[model samples]
Target chain A: MSNKKNALWHLPLIIIGIIALLPVIFMISNSFKTLQESYQSILSVIPNKPTIDNYTTLNHQVNLVRLVWNTFFMATLVTVGKLFTGLLAAYAFRYYQFKHKNLIYLLFVATIFVPFTIVMIPNYLVIAKLNLLNSVIGVALPQLCDATGIMIFLKTMEKIPGSLFDSLKIDNIPNRRIFFNIVLPILKPSIISVGAMFFINSWNEYVWPTLILKDKSSFTLPLALQNYISSEGGTNFPLAMALSSIMIVVPLIIYLIFQRYILNSISNSGLK
Target chain B: MHNNKKILPFLYLMPTGILLTIFMIIPIIYTFYLSFFDWNLIAPTKDFVGMRNYIEVFTDPVNQKVLMNTFFYIILLLVLNFIVPYVISLVVKFFIKRMQGAYKIIFFIPSLFSLVVGAMIFSWLLNPVSGPVAFLFRESGFVLPNWTNSGGLAIIVICLITNWKVFGYNFILLLTGLGSIPKNIVDATTVDRIPKWRMIWNIVLPMNKSIAIYVLILTIVQGLQYVFTPINVITTGGPYYGSSNVLYHTYLNAFVLYKTGNASALAITTFLIFLVLLYLEIKFVEGRSRYE
Candidate 1:
């Protein structure tokens, strides 16, 4: 009798889950459909006539290869920059004490609350003044100030045994060697978790890249997609669906493979 | 050698600090300064406008609609993403014991992609002419409106899409929160043969307060900005700028219109509003957790 009660709730779960998956199912199905089929068979869960016409058209029209490459380049640079800055800053906050250390640390933490919109205009102006507009460096430079990663790494670093640090110190080990040899090894998991998050976030970043990158040739996937969407409409549903799939496929695969680490990183820092 | 130790910490902090100071702190301060000036993006000079830009933001009809849209979006997210998802997760946690991992992965799939991509997919699905939802409505003998073209309804449609993309992340967070609740507490209460609803009311809800507040703040933050994707992708904040929120409005003002002064003013106002909401959250919600 009680088992029936438990099983009854599964109805809601199944219903919501189907609703959640509907968009993906629709997008994929629409991507496969030809233009006429997509319009006529709109309610069809499966494409009546599957074709690769949309992808071919998109590839021909907008240099999909270059957009993907630019996105990868920007995301990679931002990830590396965040990792380096996060590790160094976390090391400083965790290992050392200095005058006004609390103040300086507070300054870093305070940026967490300040929305990026507040600073975007001035940063754009600064980039414009330096003539870095339409460049990848300008797109990625301002985003490298990542306080969340520093916070996450520092919190993880705190859990490391104090005795290990003392033992290394007793041997009169140089700071650089200790960081490279011991600290880096111990921080590997966190690095992966944090780095993957940084990578995912950078991949999805839109506003900053849009602001900084103005040239069509230099555009990231998102900027390129935005441009396409604005210029195109429902007449090009298959093309839009195709581009959406391409944009989604990368991060979806990455998340599925490294789901545990991404979830861990988010829950680890996000809740607290 | 002893003096070098005093500066070692500074050396370690230099890279991140320099980046933060240059890109974050200085620009934030510069935003405040820029808000006071009437400057166009291409202009060589900024006229001292005092509080005129701020006054203009409060007085502007477009900004007023932008503010309403932002609030409406946030309320819808709180309902769609928070209240509804929380209930669903509780049911999933307590009753549906089998295939938990599959459920989490399936639900979280939407969040793996960018909001922009999700927006694109949804715009196609919610398309009035040949989209599936409209097709279903038509099959059912009702004419569905063009959602993106409508004024008030566009915000609702955008929120629905935003929730579809985001609720999974929040669902997992709530599931984690539920998981964090001590099993012993629930087991202890169950010995009295108390009803499940009462047990949930007295035990589960109270224990889950902190995570609830965290999710609330997160929802507010995401809601304020999440509409930007759909507004840009699907509507372009058109149909009389119906779906445009403050963030998108600010973007249009600065980048499209080149009204840097107005954009900066709106940005500052948005930040302050966020601060006030955060403060209230801490004061009310965070304070309640102390009794636990």
Candidate 2:
């Protein structure tokens, strides 16, 4: 009887949780609906007649393929950049002892909390000076190093017994070789979660991309999606939904694939 | 061997060091330096204008409103994005033990999308004309006020949009923190027959306080950022600077209006204010987190 009562307690939370995802459901469902059907059945979740028309319209109108490809490229570049640099920084912090290492690592960690506003203008100027404005590389360049990825890796390394490294040290192996051969395999899961975080963050990043990405073809997913909303006079609901669905699809897939680790490791994983 | 040890570490650090210096460190210092200049982005000559921009930030009535709007964003975001999520995490963790994975994934779904996307979805759903909610209101015989036209309502609409994107991620974060508490300690509360509220207050909250404080500080510091995309997407800080916060205003001043000096001053001032807040949080909250 008591167990049954406890089961009943799940109802309110389940209802609220489903309710929370209403907009997500709405976005997905409406993406399949015709533009007329979308407004005709505003509250209806399931499209009266599912069609790929909206997506085709969106593709031709927004050059969706180019935007998706550019977004994918930028996001991947950032993920790779952050992972590579973050791994090296964390490895050095973990393995080799250097003077003021703790202070330096703390400084790296401190960068995690520096508000975006403080960096926005100056970084923009620097990127422009580099003649990279309105270029996809410009969007990817500034975010190439993430302090949070370093934090996540450091936390992951804390679990690997120090004896493993000590043995490698005794063998006179190069640190680079040991990092590639040993640390890479061991930190795979942490790397994946952190990489997914970087990818998804870059994918969903709006403000910085908004500033740098002025050219239509260069706009990342968020920038492209925002363009749809703002330029359409905010009334092109069906097209926006279709674009949003496309925008969210990558993160959605990432979430499903990494759900277990993403949930478990969010406390340690900070995405700036 | 000893020589290799020191040099190797520096070698490993160089790439990260270079990136951080360009992107984070120098930019911060540059912001402070620019705050003293009367320079436009396109202008050839730069004039030194020591602290005048900072004075303008304080005295300009428009900026005063921006500052006030920023405080409102901070307070409302704390409730929606921070406290509400914390409470929801507790409820889901404790009460909804069954299908916890379902709850976690479902709650976190909204967070998977961008704030710009969230803003777009919500502006439609809550639009006064031909919107689902507005239609419902009309059926009940009243017109819903158009939020985009009104300044206060615009701020609220943006906040709700941020909350939609932020709530689940924060819930998952707090849930993870709560999950780290040893099961035996939680079991002890049940065995003692402690009332639920008291157990939560006397035990659960104290134990989870450190991560909670981190999340709280994140809420305070990130509030403006979370609002940025939404405002930029839909409002443009409109109804005439009604919905703008410090960060957005800073971005606009520098990028949109070419007032680099004013923007830099605003940016540095905002940075220092947040730095002080973070210091206080570390001093007071983390200092007292004995469990940590």
Candidate 3:
């Protein structure tokens, strides 16, 4: 009976797995096809004559290296910044109690729900006033201190017993050492989880970057690709697919490297 | 030593308080201040709008429609967001424990694509002529709606694109929740001869309430902003402005129309709605946690 039930469950898993992978397979296959072949049939899973012309074209027009660099630089900066700030804040919230602690924590948590649109205009105003418009800093600034990251870190820190802190104090370890030498080591999974999330979010972020960085020189991968599409028109499906393939490939590599850490963090953080 | 130790906690907390106050708290207060003014990029003088913008936004038929459309999209996307991914996650969790990592990577790849890139790709796929979707319908002997141009279909297509982009992340989140369930509980249910479906329905789902609520809140909040890109790229909130959401409407007001005050008003309203929802969620979760 258990075997039959297990078999029934496995059937859906196999089917959904295929469905989940279908678009990616479709994308990669079409990326190598000529534009003519892409339109011949929507259901075409294999290219008739695969070519690298689409990739070559994208490489030339999109300035792929610079775009990738900008994306990586911005994503890394934002991720690191958010991690530091979030960790510090979480540490503070977890290990310390002060006036209006709960109230302040609630306020920070409240910002998580403040739609980016609501803050976009004012944030732009501030960025503009600071003369940071059209720069990577402008694009990465608002994301540097995420409320969700802080909350995740706080939750993770809460899991650590208070006795650890007391013991650290007894050993005459300073608060700074307690944070760095003890708290941070145990918070590694949470940091990895939050860092991966922030990295992916910053890497994939479009609207804010598009709005903030109007200069072509500072364009991230997504913005650069969008410009390529708008300028060239949407007829070059193969080229677009090639660019899409590159976009997916980069993050997929990161995710693969950090898959276990990411999963562990997600599960442990209670963020699921 | 005890008094000095008490002071250390405050010292530890001071940096975060300062940073939050300077960055987040101050900016939110500034947002409130900006919402009351009529200002533009090119203009030197700022006029005190005195609730005029809010009144105009509330009274405008277009704004009303956009508000309704925002709610409609949220409701529709929420259903897709929860149901499809939850079911897929449950199925994936049930089987393929050994190959779960590979399955997760495959599912999450789309979510890693930039929203603009995803939007552009889908926009191409949904192109009326010389597009794959159209060609497929033709081959299948079925009519294809002009997805990006047709009013109702455009929204549905956008929803589908969002579903494709987000379902993997949702699935991973659900999988994470499922992973945390103690194996002994499941073993007990099995040893008692309880049916698997009944066990999942009666046991697993109930145990994952916090995760479920977290996902729900994130989906609703994220879905509101998701409308911004598609509305910008594909329709520009067109076909008699059917696709105009609150976010898109605010974008149009500020960028296109140069009505900064009206845009700010719209933004304020959007912020308030989500804030209220979040407050209720926090209350609900906290209350439940206490009860448990």
Better of 1 and 2 by lDDT: 2
Candidate 2 CAPRI classification by DockQ? medium
For residues B1-292, could you state the per-residue lDDT of candidate 2 as single tens digits?
7887769889989999999898998999988898999988788988999889999999999999999999888889999889988887888777655687888878887877888888888888887887899999999998899888888889988998888778878888888888888889888989989887788888889988877877888787777788988899788999889999999999899989999999999998888878876675556443632211
lDDT scores of the candidates, listed in order: 0.80, 0.83, 0.77
Clash count of each predicted structure: 0, 0, 0
Candidate 2, residue A225: how far the Cα is off, in Å: 2.0
Comparing 1 and 3 by TM-score, which wins? 1
Give per-residue CA lDDT, model 2, range A90-153, as digits (tens).
Answer: 8888877678876687577567568888898888888899999988899889899987788789
Q: Model 3: how far is B99 from its true place, Å?
A: 4.9
lDDT of 2 at B284: 45
Candidate order (DockQ): 2, 1, 3
Q: Point to the candidate with the largest lDDT.
A: 2
Candidate 3 colliding pairs: none
DockQ, Cα level, model 3: 0.51
Instruction: State in Å the error of residue B36, model 2.
Output: 1.3
Please give each candidate's TM-score: 0.93, 0.95, 0.91
Query: Mind giving the per-residue lDDT tens digits that candidate 1 earns over A145-262?
Result: 5877887788788888868888887898999998999889888878887887788778887878888898899888888777666665436777878888888888877887788877
